[model samples]
Target: MKNDSTPITKSRGPAEHEVRAQIVAAATEHFSHFGYEKTTVSDLARVIGYSKAYIYKFFESKQSIGEMICGNCLREIEAEVSAAIGQSDQPPEQLRRMFKACTEASLRLFFRDRKLYEIAASAATERWQTVIVYEANIQRLLREVLQAGRLSGDFERKTPLDETTMAIYLVMRPYLNPLLLQYSFDYTEDAPVQLSNLVLRSLSP
Candidate 1:
């Protein structure tokens, strides 16, 4: 799902955007209530009071709805990280804050809307467009932070920037990857700050 706008394919009849919105709104509540895994397209149609054929006009499968919902949640987490990064000028501090904010926001999501987490796992495993874009944004953020760090001598210039950025992403992946995050969550209580500090020390010039 595109973050800015939901794309509408060619259609006839009622406004396609509106219909999709209606379906999505109903589906959102339904997924939250009944959870995503067991809910079938038929179940969703019944829950939303629409025929399965009507729903199929907008979404090809149940996974599409879950992808959109999961996309929105990933965007929310990205927004939290961006806000955290903006709060500090020092690259090292920004990096630490990015980790901290991401972990906190995701943990809050985990505790509050676990069904979404399952959707995320599915999205990640499927390598959906939403997941691809989400990961790219994260890597972009890391590259920016590292570029600033190198300029400020907060990080070493010996390593290639791409390599450094990738290494950092890999280090943070366990907490970031929803497929593995719940498993990683147990050790993450104090790990965000601690891990960031360790990475910062290694980056220090």
Candidate 2:
């Protein structure tokens, strides 16, 4: 336990940085096994061999730690989506691949660890910064694909880019949002392809 007299520095040393990393690692493992909502900073302190006050030095609250973990899971999904769409395929094919990849990546998270899924659910429900950034990135990726399609003269130029991107993102929202996704799981396999095809047709020149 850090004494009240201990002077907290404005900057973190390498040792302090390592301590932060350890706290995050321990929290992630604990949350994965026991779920995020059920765990408290006190619980983390007990498990991490640190005082609650000490953990507070690294993270102000449990949700702050949950945000980091949830952010990671969402970013991993985006990374997978980026990789899947990295091919030189036509814009139509690329878009289809994006949808499929997103569904796969999100499903991977749900099936990998339900406790982690619980974190995602809470994040999505509460509209955390991670969810905001993740959704924006998805829109940005959609905009890029739409731009490519239009440039190739394969998609209609009548619809504005912003409109098209938002429309497409809204269509894909259920697959992207963990909270909404749980209710729509049944459509995961066929929805991506069929929905992508439908979107492609709508965007056709």
Per residue, candidate 2 scores C-alpha lDDT tens digits across 1-205 of 1011211222222357788778889999998899898999999999999999888877777888888777767767777787788874588888999899988898888658888888888888898877787788888887888898899998999988999899999998888888888888999989999999999889889
Q: Candidate 1 regions off by >4 Å?
A: 1-15
Clash count, one per candidate: 0, 0
TM-score of each: 0.89, 0.90
Q: Which pairs of residues collide in model 2?
A: none
Q: Residue-wise lDDT of candidate 1 within 152-174, one digit each (tens)?
A: 98899999999999998998988
Among these predictions, the greatest lDDT belongs to: 2
